[model samples]
Target chain A: MLEIRNLTASVGGNQVLNGINLSIQAGTVHAIMGPNGSGKSTLSNVLAGHPQYIVDGGEVLFDGVDLLAMPPEERARAGIFLCFQHPVEVPGVRMDHFMRAGYNAIHKSHDEEELDPIQFDRILKDKAKIVEIDPLLLKRNVNEGFSGGEKKRNEILQMAMLEPKLSILDEPDSGLDVDSLRIVAEGINQLRSPDKAVLLITHYQRILNYVVPDVVNVLINGRIVRSGGKELAAEIEANGYEGQGEALQPSA
Target chain B: MTTPDSLAQSEYKYGFVTDIEEETAPRGLTEDTIRWISAKKNEPEFMLEWRLRAFKHFMTLVENHQEPKWANVHYPPIDFENGVYYAAPKTNPASLEDVDAEILSTYEKLGIPLEEQKRLAGVAVDAVFDSVSVATTFKETLGKQGIIFGSFADAVQEHPDLVKKYLGSVVPYTDNFYAALNAAVFSDGSFCYIPKGVRCPLELSTYFRINAAESGQFERTLLIADEGSYVSYLEGCSAPMRDTNQLHAAVVELVAMENAEIKYSTIQNWYPGDENGVGGIFNFVTKRAKAAGNNSKISWTQVETGSAITWKYPSVLLQGDNSIGEFYSVALTRGYQQADTGTKMTHIGANSRSKIISKGISAGHGSNTYRGLVKIMPKAANARNFTQCDSLLIGDQCGAHTVPYVEVQNSSAHLEHEAFTSKVSEEQLFYCRQRGMSSEDANSLIINGFCKEVFQQLPFEFAVEATRLLEVSLEGSVG
Candidate 1:
């Protein structure tokens, strides 16, 4: 459902993603494990169409469409979701309104009838339960004064709301405690389907323990050097990223 | 996808002029010009003398070059002599039916229904068009409650004693350059007074419109809430688009008596200049309220999103024991607009309190500044004040500034002031965009969030209007 061909990207004039090739079919969860500064977050940002991350030379295809040619919003409308590493705090914008706007925008792009507040409220309440998010948190401002765990849960809740095809979870487990990690992983698992895909980007294999990935790839210096079954995550978890990139393919 | 930059370049929506025959005084601010305005309104002897006194004081300020350049705004020196001080529709309307169709349609176009049947329920309106009150609705209904509400001209004619007692009591003619100018040539504005112990039955509002080209709108509004009374007043204004800058200098005064409470809200959408800042209204207004008796309260809430240059500070003087003053403001400046606005709270009695919340949004080359002051007198023991000023900048080219001055003479006074300046970061914008909102929608959402506190203070209808106004004003401000 998604393909990346020589995806070279840079931010602030420094090349971050150097000559990367990856492909994911439907109903598969792919894990990209790397140490810090290994461009794990950069891959997610590039897919999400962040303005600062310039595409120096590359092309991304989502379901045969030129994904890189779209803006952030269009990419989102096209079912590309990137769970941010650090959720931005938007003070005074209520969680319900923010979620509802995004949900309705995507729905409208698909020529679906938009749900009114009352209708959406019921659906939101149900989604909140899937993630075990307290319904009251939806009344507060988005990510303002929220605990790290709550922010992660809120992102998962948004993912549940949008029901995107390609869900990129960027370190969703980084700041979570054991309990929150379970809830977030359970929520992601509940949303998994045969026709949807997940790109789980993380430095550790702990989250993989809960929502086991179908494939695990080790990323080093912006290049995915090794691809194997789920056992590769356990290997990285034990040995770390050291000597993981010795088989790096030369850049095109 | 539609680029927001081009969308923001849309023309000001309320820029259409009303083609009506007007009776205007000669262009200039001479003594005779003031006399001509006073005669045109058929003012009493003392009123004429008052105008002359204010005119003399204004002339002295002009001679001394005291046109208040202290504000963080830039504009060429105003040629006071080249502008018309008075411009009113030719036929004065004794009733809504007598008003010209053109003038009435103008109000309808501006979303203000002046006709009785079509008027907004639970709200009384006074429509002021270019130096004259064209229509005032629900007069009889308010009069039955002993609430006197009408035009300033009518107040002087029908309730001379009341008008004389409080016209310049709060903002005197000697207050400042703009106040003096407004006092001298002020043509028409709303006059409202709530009787003792009577809560005003309806929301009273004044809508000011500048329709005639080259005419300066100088309107003076005075509202009084007698002992134990309560009232909420709203003011809104707009102007037609013109290449030559027009002047709008207004003065508003409020007096709240013992146990009385007065709430004032303003949604100012005066015409801002073109994107390049060619010409617009130079809005220099003076608004002040006095909590004159014990336990009285006065609150000012404003959403200012118009005018090329705005220099106004609605203030409150807490004189009675345990009195209170509050100011909630949201000032949005886009394009070439500049606004230097905030408030002043003066604590004169023991246990007086004041709260100020200001939000300023600057986009394009706009500049917004929050300049406020909180002063506690030596005798005012245990006075308290809380002030918060937050500014949000949309683009890198715009600017936001906060200047607060606090003076506490009493040891028992407690004051807290918090300020923050935040840019609409790319991260936040991108996050919203990635969630399916367009860049423009994301920008508006973030700005509305930043201004939510102030918007909550507005009346429901006005809040909706203010939100839409902000969206229109900040269009094309973001990529």
Candidate 2:
């Protein structure tokens, strides 16, 4: 469902991602884990087409289309979703208006009939329930004063509403408490489908305990250092990537 | 904004002028200039004297003043001698049927057709073109309810007593420099009266359109709601595109007597200059309201989205014990436009209260400022006032400022002021656009949300118009 080949990118004249290759198939969940300054978050930002990140080399293919050629909005229209680690708080925009606009715009790109406010409200409420979001939050400004857990839940609510083909959760568990972590994992598990793919990025194994991954890759020094099964996480957990990654490799 | 209508993308939708013969006063401000305007309107002797008095005061101000250097706006010194103080279309149709077709079409293009105005329920319109009131609609129905709704000129000629009683009652001619100039040569504006104990059955509205070139429009509006009466008045004005700047200094006074309530809403789309700000209207207006008796209430709501330079503060005086006043404003300055608008709330009676909400938007090279004052008199014990001012900047090239003044003479008085300023960052824009909304749609959605508080104060029809006006006004502000 998604493919990245030799992707190299920079932000503010500093290299973030270099010579990275990854691919994910439908019906599978993949997790990327790495220490700080290891390019884990940059990988997701590059996939989301953040303008600040200059793509220095290579290409990305989503559903057999040149995803790198698309603008951020078009990438979103093509069913690519990025759940930000820290969602922005738009003080005046209502959550209902924001979600409805997303739903309508996504439907519009597919040349489908858009839902009216009343009709969209029903779907929105159902999605909010999937993530156990407070219905009252829907009426307030978008994440204006939402708690950390609520912001993560809102990203899930939007994901449920948009129903993208590929979902990238970028550190979605960073701000969640124990119960919220379970709820967020449960929400992600519910979205699992034969035609949908999930790429979970995280720094700890706490969330992996709830939503286990089929594949785990260790990223380091702007590149993926190793690709292995989910057991790779347990191994890294026990023996930190001190001597395993290229950082400890002998010069030349 | 929803679909990028050509009307929004166009430089200026209501920028076309109608060619017609006009009678213009001499292009100079002199004692005779004031008398010529008063004489042309066939004013009463007392009205002439009032104009003379205001003219002498205005001259004195012109000699000592420095063109209000305190406002957060810059413009070339106005050529007072180059603009005609009055210009009226040369046609007097005894009835709507005989009115000129060009004049009728002009109103139709502005989306207020006099013929169909009667078909509109609960809305009576008085269309003012240049310095004259063109045609007033739905008067008979309003007249049946003892409500007087018509041109100020007509009220001066027919209802002289009512006009004379409230003309400058709230905003005296000596109020400000602009008010003094407007008092000296003011032309036709809407005049409305709700009789005692009678609630007006319809909304009294006025549409001011400035079409003549090199002309200054000084309109005067007076509204009086008697004891136990209620009324709502809406004003919408615009002007055609012109290469030379036009002066628009108008005065509005509203009085709400014992147990009376008055609600006034304005959506002004005066001609804003081009992208570079070559020429536009310098709107210097003084709009004020007075709660004259116990339990009286007055509310002022304005959506100001045009003009090259806007310097106005629609204020209210809570003079009666337990009276209430409110001011809600949304001002947007795009391109090279500059606006310094807010409100004033003066509490003079015990237990009086006031509330003010202002939103300022600046995009492109535009500059927007919110300047407000809330004063509690020494005798106004237990008075209360709450003020909120928010500013939104769309681009890095724009500017926004908030200047608030609070003066309380009594220890028991309570005042609360809240202010916030934020920029339309790339993160917010990208977040909205990533959800598939176009940039324009996203920008307007954010803006509409910011202005929802003030927009709710407008009539339903005017609310939609205000939204559309903002969409078109800031069409090019967003990337």
Candidate 3:
């Protein structure tokens, strides 16, 4: 569903992602693990079309479309969802209204009829239960004054509402407690389908225990150095990246 | 002159005028003109005498004064001698039903239905065209509730005692140049009174439109809420497009007696000049409300999005013990418009309180300024005041400024003021766009969010209307 070829990105003239290549197919979960300053978050941001990150060279193809040529909103409408590690707190925009706007934009882009308030509300209430996000949170301003855990859960709730084709969870488990982690994992599991793909970016294996990935890629020095199966994640958790020196080898 | 094709493609929707018959006064200011206006309105002899006195004062003030240049405003010198001082609706209606159809259609075009069934519920309307009161609806119903709802002319005639006692008592003729001009040649506005111990049953609204070319609208509105009474008054203004800049100098005075409460709201959407600042209304107004007697309260809420050059300060005199005063405003300036607006709150009584919240949005080459003052007199012991002023700039070409003057004579007074000015950040916009909102939608959402604090202060219906007005006012630039 997604393809990246030699993606070299820079922000403020500082190269953040240098010649990184990756691919993901439908119905598969991929995990990208890296230490601090390893460009894990930058990869997610560049894929979401953040204007600050200038793609110096290379290509990103989503379902055979030129993803790099699209604007951020067009990318979102093309079913590319980025769950921010630090969710933005947008004051005065009610969560329900924000969700409806996101839903309508994607739905309209795909030639689907938009849902009215009544129909949308009924669907949102049921989805809120799976994410363990209180329905009352939808009435308040989007993520305003919410705790860190609540913000992460809110992002998951949005991900559920959008039902994007390629979902990038950027450290979604960083702020979640044990129970929230399980709930977020359960929500992702429920959203799994044959036509959807998931890319999980994380620093710990706690979340991987709940939503196991089919493949794990170790990112270092702005490149994907190694790719392996789920056992690679377990091995990295047991012995830190210090012992896995081969995984740090530069990829051609 | 710009081609019609060029001007026709302009996006200002309310820049057109309606054709109607008018009885216009000859251009120029003189004792004769004042007397002519008094006679035209069939004013009482005493009122005529007062107008003559004001006219004399106007002549003295104009002769001794040079045009004040300190207001941060630039406009061609107003040729007072070549401007019409008064114009009244020639069609007099014995009842609202007998009103002129063309004039009624003008209101209808503005989406304000004059018919009772289609009128805004529980809101009495006093419609003013140019310098005359065309019609006042719900008069009988308001009168049954012991409310005085009429034009300023009628108030001067039937309720001379009340008019004479309160007129200029709060804002004297010498308050400013425009105040003096308004006092000398003011033609018409609304006069509302809620009797002592009686709560007004409905919202009192007045709509002012400058429909005549070269005609200056100098309207004076006075609203009095008697002891223990409460009233809410709303004012709206608009003007037709004219190459020669038109002047609109209005004065509004409000009085809240002991235990009385008054809420005055204004939505000023007069014609702002073209993008290059060619033509529009030059609005210079002086509006003040005094809270007299103990436990009185007065509040001013305004949404100002129009006028080529707007200079107005809606103020409050908190003279009543434990009185409360508030000013909430959202001023938007697009194209070449310039607005210097805010409020002044004076605390003279013990335990008085005041709150001021001003939000300004500037786009294109527009300039938005917030000039406010809060004064606590020596006698106002333990008084409190809070002010928050925020400005949002849409484009780099625009400017936003804040100047607040605070004076606290009482050692026990507590006052806090905060001000911030910022442009919409690219990061914020990108965040919303990443959520599937277009740049225009993102900008509008951010602007609306920035103004939510002040917009929420308006009544529910007015809030909705104000939001829509903000959206419409920010159309071209936001996209």
Candidate 4:
């Protein structure tokens, strides 16, 4: 479970997230739909503890622990995963090597037995299949020269491997084709469980058709304006984010 | 007692000086110093004549003030007369057992155990302490295979013919100012020779340690692979922390005969001074390998992570038809360290080929430069060379430069060059950190990836040590 109480953040001296308040229960998928510059990505970055994003005001708690105080790596080890909109290219860093380092790091922080290369390979291969990622790509550098669809699928693969408690998919469907989008949606659907939560941040409602959300919240100007069922996604799709903030009351 | 802050501040882990009585030549570089070094080694008359000739030439260069001002590095004029030319542990060890415990412990502390039981498997080591080699492991085993592996001083006495024939054959003493200086006062280094048609059974290594303060270590390493022979040689250099700069002018020459192959790797970790860069070793080295006969091959793999100022170019002279030359280097300069290193591939024989891959990493106020040359003569038909230079900067104050010169007189020659410079982006760092790695680990991971190509060229154990060395060298380089 996670709780955000009037969380305000800024980036590069510009206030982006203006007192955002949201609460997500375990096992529920929450979709935050907003237009560009509405601070959807800012919220995701602030929650993941990105260094550039300063917490200007308010507080965020993950399992009753202060999330804003932890460093990015500590937040990651504590099971907060943010699938980047554009994954960075880490030249010469093999995907498997990077993943294994992350896997062992998180495991060690939790006092769990770490998996060696051989043991980890089996788990990686199985997870790769669930995400429909070509195993050959795992031998190459991380996100180096990866196509748009492949990058999204790679992020899903990492999500599957890390098994985070709260997964923030930031524009995962942004540069994907129909077939790639279907695969990403299916991967997310397969990763859903009663002990986990998914916060899907997107500007488009197309992905909502594939992995329907339990709660759909419209974010306008860094604040959640409307909260409704999955039908709210269809409503937004039919009538975009324009004038939605003025029409709907702020949700508690 | 060292705090974590001090440890990170001065990441030169091998900065400890061995406390032992030493026999040092009087401070200064003169004819008497050369004679003392030659007499101390008991070198043959021909060897002494060569040293005198070199010393005379070195004096001429000094008179002309030709201290190689072409390189893009800045330093105060060196005080040659104020530094000791030779400084060695007092006792001369006739065998491993006779080696002084303090000297042996110095090697052990450096992770290079001279004891038989703790010796690294398949790596015959010759531990050079200051001016003389104190211990040579697996000498008998190597000798049984008609492979002469021992100290250069011993080779001058035992295998004078081999030493005389190949010495200065690739990098002549007249080649440069430092080469002449090294040839004149070079105290001792490893000497190896593989007989015809023999592949050396194990790796040959030389570990040079500079413990005596205010002494310059002039090491001369010569390796010869006879016709149809093969050998892999590696050299490691380090020095203690000092307030005054020490000089390390070394010359390494390798000869690969017909159908022979020679592979040379170096892990140079001399002291890079404190964060303020007050004192350290000035490593001026000349390393060259010659493919003397048709179909021979020579490769140089180096990981240079230390030294206050490094100026060296490990080159390959492709004199034989169909010969191959390769240079893989990873030069990392942190703090105020400066490195100007690369390679030269000269194609004199038809169908000769060479490949160069260099990675330079600069952190703090460090400066790194890759200055390489690829030349193909008019008579050399169908020669080929491919070069790739990549530079990585960790902090804003650091700098990287790539200067590649290509001269092709033959129209049939084919050459290609690629160079790229990139900063350690904040996004890359955040990406790795978000994957659960600490900032240090993330920085190291990114650097290791950037250096993967060069590290893979090293031998297994050397590769592992080189990786760890890069990690240590990059300490405190980032927040």
lDDT of each: 0.92, 0.87, 0.86, 0.91
Cα lDDT of model 1 by residue, A82-114, tens digit: 998899988889999999999999999999999
Off by over 4 Å in 2: A244-252, B1-10, B65-67, B117-119
DockQ (C-alpha based) per candidate is 0.82, 0.57, 0.61, 0.81
Candidate 3 local lDDT, A57-77, one digit each (tens): 999899999999998999999
Q: iRMS for all predictions?
A: 0.4, 1.3, 1.3, 0.6
* Of candidates 3 and 1, the better by lDDT: 1
lDDT of 4 by residue, B193-284 (tens): 99999999999999999999878899999999999999999989888889788899999999999999999999999998888888999999
lDDT of 1 at A204: 91
B22-73, model 3: which lDDT tens digit per residue?
A: 8899778888888888888888887777777777777776687644567767
Show pairs that collide, candidate 1: B8-B475, B8-B476
- State residue B181's C-alpha deviation in candidate 3, in Å: 0.6
lDDT of 1 by residue, B1-479 (tens): 34334435456899998988999998777889998999999999989999999999999998999999889999989988677999999998778789999998999999998887789998899999999999999999999999999999999999999988998999999999999999999999999999999999899999999999988999999999999999989989999998989999999999999999999999999999887898899999999999999999999999998899999999999999999999999998878899999999999999999999999988778899999999999989999999999998766778999999988899999999899999888898899999999988998899999999999988898889899988877766666
* Model 4, C-alpha of B146: deviation from truth (Å): 1.3
Q: Model 4 chain B, poorest ten-residue lDDT window?
A: B1-10
**What's the distance in Å from true for residue A170, model 2?**
1.0
After superposition, the stretches of candidate 3 with alpha carbons farther than 4 Å from their true spots are A108-122, A175-179, A242-251, B1-10
Error of 3 at B36 (Å): 1.6
Q: What DockQ class does candidate 1 belong to?
A: high
Candidate 1 residue spans exceeding 4 A from truth: A247-252, B1-8
